[model samples]
Target chain A: MSLLRLRRASLSYPAGGGSVEVLRDVDLTIRRGEFVTVLGRSGAGKTSLLNLAAGFVAPSSGAVEVDGRPVTGPGADRAVVFQDDALLPWLDASENVAFPLRLKGAGRAERLERAAALLRLVGLEGHERKNLWELSGGQRQRLGIARAIAAEPEFLLMDEPLGALDAMTRDRMQELLLKVWRASGAGALLITHSVEEALFLGTRVVVMEPRPGRIGLDEGLDFSARFLEGVPARALKAEPAFIAARERLIAAIHAEEAA
Target chain B: MTVSATNLPERAASRFPSGGRPALPAAFLRRLPVFAALFTLTAVFGLWWIASARGWAPPVFLPSPDRVWKAAQIAADTGYASATLGQHAAASLGRVMAALLVTLLIAVPAGFVLALSPVGRGLLDPLIEFIRPLPPLAYLPLVIIWFGIGEGSKILVISVAMFAPIAISTAFGVGSASESQVRAARSFGASRFQTLRHVLLPAALPSIISGVRIALGAGWTTLVASELVAASRGLGYMIQSAAQFLVTDMVIVGILAISLFAFGFEILFRLIERFWLPWSRRR
Candidate 1:
């Protein structure tokens, strides 16, 4: 079953005297264990689509459903990794991961134990007590991912989760994300402007266009599975097939610009 | 070869031929501001002593440091204006603290409400602005007439003085809570009250604490002024009566006592800010 589905969803905001359409007739879906990436230029409403899936915003028309149930508002079933890695500053690393469990009324010992396990899964085993400011940017993002998965949500919605990181850190995070996604088996819809990242991490990639944004291309690829089968990221990127796919995705985006 | 020759002299000069003095130890550098402050304080006192000794101002008016010291000892041991120095100081402190307690109890929750809800802010913003700028003393006449020159009136005056700063800062703090933090909380399925408790409250705490500190100072100032007009027991009362009687020594003692109390409270607030909100200090 599809973990999340957006059916002909449209979103618009009131601007000056009339409405400015951000997304129009946007249909997307993420089945269980599938890794989906949405690629677009700025103002292409990729984020608006993600917000609709997360139920952070409502569509002006059509439906956003999770597991056949319509999404009316945000719920624990869907978790978001925000662009800025918005971990609560007052809470230390472990406490931040444990926050959602606490919201669900889990006991102290249980939540702490679960949080420590999630932190360890994200490779932050011993840095449990470090404050948010003390953690480097990449570490903060890892903590955000840990917190997102701590609730065991069926779907993870990430909006430019690696956009703030340096190249080396982003590369390492991309590998880590594949490992976590494969292990958790939770469907993911990641939005980004990076073609390399979209190709490397996604089992399926969707390209979007702006000015009443709509999906431009939807393609299925096996790169993420090939990486899982022990094809190293560096080696895969240098392959002629990988290069060709990357070019095709870029061209699809440019086609939207020309249109 | 020419470039090498020029570079050798530049390197040698940078390494060993400097004319500047050696750098001071970190400990001494850190204490430099303290030393400067002490020097300035001592110079002011020395000037006062020299002027008094040279009869720059008559002893009856200025009263030498020795006379003030003697007055302090006398007030501490016997009494000042029918009450000992401790009693007078305590009276003023008690009124300020009482008013502060009332202000905290009322203003903090009110501030949070105003911050969290636009309707609450709309209702309260005008009233807060109107009351904030009017001097606590401006309401003195109305307070005295209503509550009758007693402890009630004086406490009410100080409480009125304190309420504005605490409420304003809390509202500002709540308003300033980062959007990302609030969104993160909501995404985790936290309700509005839970978001306030876990996110907004902690984010706004540093501002709220600083506001309370400002309100304390304002409340103290208003307490003294209120006591001057009505009360018979506080330091302000002692100083006003002593001035009328031309007892310059007693007046000096009252002023010094008030200064000492204010200084002590400032230290206490600083320590609380350091200990309770260490994360706020990091930024």
Candidate 2:
């Protein structure tokens, strides 16, 4: 199986006098079809980690590689969904989804057909012709996911893409994200502040501690797999084992914060 | 436009005024400003008519409304200086449009260069700043001396006046593209060219259209001034000639023609914007 590996990666930025290290010697590896969630507090450099994987930022040390090949910069192999959705306002919904295909030089008709299919898959059926401004926050985030998968990327890197949604919408989107990840067959690296979300969505939840950001906990869970195996989201969330895992992750993040 | 239910029934009834009497037409209330504009125009024209008819001002200085109207009819029919009013209007419009096209072609790319590249901005920034404040007329003599009294020189002078507004606005629009927007495109492996075309260009379009409107305004003024110097078949030239001969009515007719054409262009631009960038205003 293909894998994305960030081996002892470090990132820093210039500050007054000396440089400030935002992420230091963080080692992470994601296997194909795996869902990896990076949970963190405000200053945890969780976004920085996602950026590193997406090749938007270079590591100050070590490497980010795909299948042992060094990742140079953002390429077609990785697609990112941003927190704000970032759907191009100028294009209609389908056209926005087709944008990555367009960049890959896909023909017009093929691009349209693929975009229509993807939008339908993302539960935006009949919204193909609508302007992006007409979409609700949740719908736009769904479109963002559709666009990310349109590239048929090996990795889907998302940075709190559902952060702006209401509680109800966020719950629905979490399930939708699980379905998309399975359908796309891409390794997922998602960053979020919600501990329950990390637990529910991720096959492996890696909690990052802030202030010289580093991964404080890396634990594997089968909740996402269980959800796929006919377990309803509500039932799974209310399970005693699920609660224990959620509480443990929360405690771990809080302890890291206090320390 | 929905009428949501109100809590206070008494206040709602009072607002409508008992016996189920209807309120004023919504259209009338909406069109109040338009009616006010018409009234203002009528009042201004009424004052001008009375002033000229009562000889409150010299006829040569302010011709009567009828005299100006007659002059307009004559200019349209019999022509002025071997060219009819239509021809003069067309000539002026053609010059401005040509200048606008040339300005857009150059300025948009220049704007991207200015915004995207430090070296390019360093080189072009001071030059744009220098060109922006000075009026086209300031360089008209220079252009005439260098390029002579050709149509090219006229178009060149007008285009220069049109440049800064468009270029600066384009740069501003490009800058307004959010970081996530560009990064999303880049994540799809969009090349530099693709990013600019699919991402930055559309992002910049609304501002570019507004800049074109401002550039057109600047170009119109420059066209008039340039024609005042060395043009034979434009509204400005007709106005200049009519003024020299003390034909105040013809001059007024010329001025009205220019105003009408400019207003028409503004409406045309609005329609174009609505057609192409429909989401711009909605967003």
Candidate 3:
């Protein structure tokens, strides 16, 4: 069954006197344990689509559903990892990770224990007391992911989660992301402009087109499964099949741009 | 890549003979501001002493520092106007404290409301603007008429002086809370109250603290002004009464006491800011 479903969702914003459509007739589904990657250009409304799924923004037409119910507003059931890694500066790393549990009325010891475990999962052990400014960018993003999953949400909606990282850090983060996704057992819908990342991490990839943004292509692949099956990411990416798949995604994106 | 001169290791210093002996003086030079401030204070004291000793100004107008000290001693032992210097200072401090506490309790919450709600802001913005610009002394007459030469009027005057800065800065703090932080909290299903407590309040805290500091200074100033106009006790009343009788030494003692107390409060607030909100402190 689909963990999150968007049925012909459309969004428009009031631009000057008239309305400007940002997303048009977009339909997608994220099933349990699936890693879905969305590829789009800058103005393709990828964020708008993610916002619709997360219920941060309501659709102007059609509906966004999660577990067979319509999404009205943001809920703990669908946690989002933002590109900016919005950890509160006033909070230390551990406190930031424990915030969701704190909101849920968990006891101090319980929440702290859970936050410590989550921090360890994100490979930030012994850095629990570090202030937000003390954390490196990649560590902050990892903290963001840890915070997202601390609530044990059914779906993780990520918007360009690794967009700000350097090449080496981005590669490491992608591997870590897959590991976290498998451990949490939650469906993910991540939006990115990187074709390599989309091919590397996603079980299913969707391409979005701009100028009244809509889904351009949807394809299923097995690279993530192969990577899970003891194939290292470097070896997997260097394989002919992986290269062909990456080319196909890139070609699709470029073709959509031309269209 | 070319090696830069900055990256090169330093050679042995020929001028020092034993590495560098200037380290001590360099360290002292780094503390130049402290010495400069001390020197400036000493010079001012020397000038005051010279002026009085040379009879540059009559004793009725500008009494010597020893005369002021003698007046302080006399006030401490015999009491001035039936109360000691301590009583006057305590009264002034009490009024400022009460007014500050009351202002903080009311204004901080009202500030949050005004910042969070458009309707609250629209309704209160004009009234706050109107009252904020009017000097605290301008309202002293009306306050005295309403509450009469009691503690009520004095505290009210100080409270009025403090309210605007505290409220406005708090509102600004809330308004300037990071949009991304609030959005992240909301995405985690944080309710309005939860957002306020967990995100908005902490984010606004630094600004709120700064507001309190500003309000303290304003409140202290207003307290003195109000006391000068109408009061049996307080440093301002003591100074005003002494000036009326041409007791220059007593007036200088009262003025110095007020300055000392204000300086002490400023240091106390700085210490509180450092200890309580360490994260807000700049590196």
Which numbered prediction scores highest in lDDT against the true structure?
Answer: 2
* Top TM-score hit: 2
Model 1, B123-199: lDDT tens digits are 88898888899897789899888889889889889988998899988888887777766776677888878888888
Enumerate residue pairs that collide in model 2: none
Q: What value does DockQ give for candidate 3?
A: 0.56
* Per-residue alpha-carbon lDDT of candidate 2 for residues B211-230, written as tens digits (9 for 90 to 100): 88788879888888889777
- Kindly list the per-residue Cα lDDT of model 3 for residues A1-259, writing each as its tens digit: 5579999999999999999999999999999799999997889999999989988899999899987799989888888998999888777898899888988888988988999999999999999899888888999999999999997888899999999999999999999999999999999999998999999999999999887999999999788888888799999999998898888878888886566
- Write the residue-wise lDDT of candidate 1 on A1-259 in tens digits: 5569999999999999999999999988899799999998888999899889988899999999988889988877778898798887777898899999888888989988998899889999999889888989999999999898986778888999999999999999999999998888889999998999999999999999888899989999788899999999999989898999999988888885676
Give the residue spans of candidate 1 off by over 4 A: B1-27
For model 2, the stretches where C-alpha displacement exceeds 4 angstroms are B1-25
Using all chains and alpha carbons, the TM-scores for the candidates as numbered come to 0.90, 0.93, 0.90
Off by over 4 Å in 3: B1-30
